[model samples]
Target chain A: QQQVRQSPQSLTVWEGETTILNCSYEDSTFDYFPWYRQFPGKSPALLIAISLVSNKKEDGRFTIFFNKREKKLSLHITDSQPGDSATYFCAASVIMGYKLTFGTGTSLLVDP
Target chain B: EAGVTQSPRYAVLQEGQAVSFWCDPISGHDTLYWYQQPRDQGPQLLVYFRDEAVIDNSQLPSDRFSAVRPKGTNSTLKIQSAKQGDTATYLCASSSLGGLNYAEQFFGPGTRLTVL
Candidate 1:
């Protein structure tokens, strides 16, 4: 079974606009949530991460809003740029856990 | 500092053939993980180790897959018999458990395997 799930298999937004990608998880034991950005033919890179203790985390123009009670999280890209076009993956893991459970991913496209 | 490195960037094998992939994690990182990513899908964890000791490997297919991190710095994943279903990109990632930055992991370029 897929423990982590992401919505909107694909998305498109204009430059300077804000885009939101949603994610949900089934395991309540999960405490750490991270977002990864991967360009084609490259490895996934860490974008932003949030611990359950916080309701939100931000890095530059990327922000992660997490709702632990709802078992859901969303990644917001402010001022979306064409360079930001890539596949975004939502992942969850337990603190000190050995592995991360990843969602199917969302393909984002930012058009100038 | 160097990032995680993987070798044999691409491999092709016939069914029933055997293959191995190697990975070298960053220095001073004690945790290493392997993940399998199918086309258009997210990566799934296959196994992980903390300083040469496997912490979890429940997702690995034991009948054909095996992995080892004997030196705590490098690891190898071997498949005894290749199958078409095994075609995927294998990724290696590493992270340090020290301080408050333990949640981040560095990934390798990955090895793309194709089983015909």
Candidate 2:
């Protein structure tokens, strides 16, 4: 029973291109959505997040567009860089995301 | 300030063997979390704590897995009678109770465990 699901197990984009990753969850009660990126051999780091109250959240070049009605979300990386190559994960939770349910993850390879 | 710290970054064990992983959370953080990440998959929550109190551990395998944050600052996860299915990376994370970094868990390097 995969609570969260991500599309395109792997993706590649040219530097400076916009990279989009999609995610969806089964639980309608989920109120918190956070994105995390993990570099090879490193731990997952929080990138950005959005709550049910907001449909969009932006942090510099990274933005998250969420649709509560659709129970879906997407993370967009504008001006993607080669250094941004990593595995991106989408997670959902009901209470501030303490008990996170993560998707399979998207491996993004930015070609410079 | 130092981020969350985990010791013995790698471990290899035989089936039925027991192993323990340790973690030291960031200073002043009251919440701690432990996750199990299998290869090519995202991390899954095993258990979490808030100031030595077990908030949730329903995802943890009670028979073989047990975690303790006795003092709340440092914690340990032990797996008894490890199985091949237990092979995965064990990650430890910490965060403050409130503020801008509320859900921003500071992760450790993680322990890569391989059960043969």
Candidate 3:
């Protein structure tokens, strides 16, 4: 069973458009949520993350809106640029947990 | 500081063969993890270690897979009698900033394995 799931397997947007990616988790015990970005032929890199204590977290043009009751979260990229094109993964872990569970990735493509 | 490093970037093998991937974590990082990523899919954790002892390896297919970080520095993952389903990119990551959960992990370029 997949503990984490992501929607819109693929997405396309014009530069400067805001794009949203959705994620849901089955494990309510998970308290740490992190987003990772992977470029072609490169390793996955940490982009942003949130804890259960907060409902929203933002960094630069990226924002994450979370709902504890729904076990759902979304990543929004505002003023998207071509360089932002890549695969994004949503991951979760319980506090003090030793590992991360990742969701199926969303591939974002931005047209310049 | 240098990032995580993996060797033998690509490997091709037939079913029933064996192969090993090596990794060297970043300096001063106390935790290491290994993950398997298939095409168009996100990575799945296989195992992890803290110092020279294994922290969790439940996700690893123990019968045919094994890993070791004897010196608490470098590690090796071996697949015995590989199968087609085992084909994927193996990534090694390390972290020290996030405590036990490792809020942020630095990943390696990964070693792609192809089994026929």
Candidate 4:
């Protein structure tokens, strides 16, 4: 049972365009949500995250819009750049442990 | 200031061979986690430890896999008999205690193991 699912396995957009990646979870107990980015031949790095109480969290050009009722959330990258092209994973956890349930990653390619 | 560090960045072994991977988490981080990531797939948690005690390892293939954190600073994952199906990248991550759940984790470069 896939506890977390992501849409659009792959995406391509021109530089400066806004790109959106969507994620949904099945576990209601999952209150911690985080987005990670992975580059070729490297480890996945934390990009941004959100808690249940917040509907939105923004850091610079990255924004996360979360809906608790729908059990869904999205990552929006404004003014995307070529450097932002990488695999993005949405993860959730029920508690403050490190056992994360991850979603199938989305491969984003930003063309210059 | 150092992030999580993993050893044997790449390993190749034949079926039935034994292999081990090591991880050194960030200093002062109390929680450590290991994940297996197949090509194009999301990472799957295999095990985790908090101060030398295992928190969860239900996903681990008990028959062939084992993990340990003796001093609470570093960890080792051993595969007794590797199989071709075990080919994947092993990732190590760590987070602080106060931010264990809320604080994002730092990841290592990972060890790519190939079982022929």
What does candidate 4's lDDT look like per residue over B13-107, in tens digits? 99999999999999998889999999899899999998899999999999999999999999999999999999999999998867244756889
TM-score chain B for all models: 0.97, 0.96, 0.95, 0.96
- Tell me the tens digit of each residue's lDDT in model 1 across B1-116: 88899999999999999999999999998999999999999999999998999989999999999999998989999999999999999999999877774448889999999999
Give each prediction's DockQ, rounded to 2 decimals. Answer: 0.70, 0.72, 0.69, 0.73
**Model 4: how far residue B64 lies from native, Å:** 0.2
Candidate 2 accuracy as lDDT: 0.93
10 residues in a row with least lDDT, candidate 3 chain B? B95-104
Fnat per model, in the order shown = 0.70, 0.78, 0.73, 0.78
Tens-digit per-residue lDDT, A39-104, candidate 3 = 998989999998898999999999999999999999999999999999999999884434889999
What is the per-residue lDDT of model 2 for residues A47-99, given as tens digits with 9 covering 90 to 100? 99999889999999999999888899999999999999999999988877677
| Tens-digit lDDT track of model 1 for A1-112 | 9899999999999999999999999999998888899999999998888888899898899999998889999999999999999999999988653478899999999999
Local lDDT at A82 for model 1: 98
- Report clash pairs, candidate 4: A96-B101
lDDT of 3 by residue, B1-116 (tens): 89999998999999999999999999998889999999889999999998999988999999999999999999999999999999999999998864443447899999999999
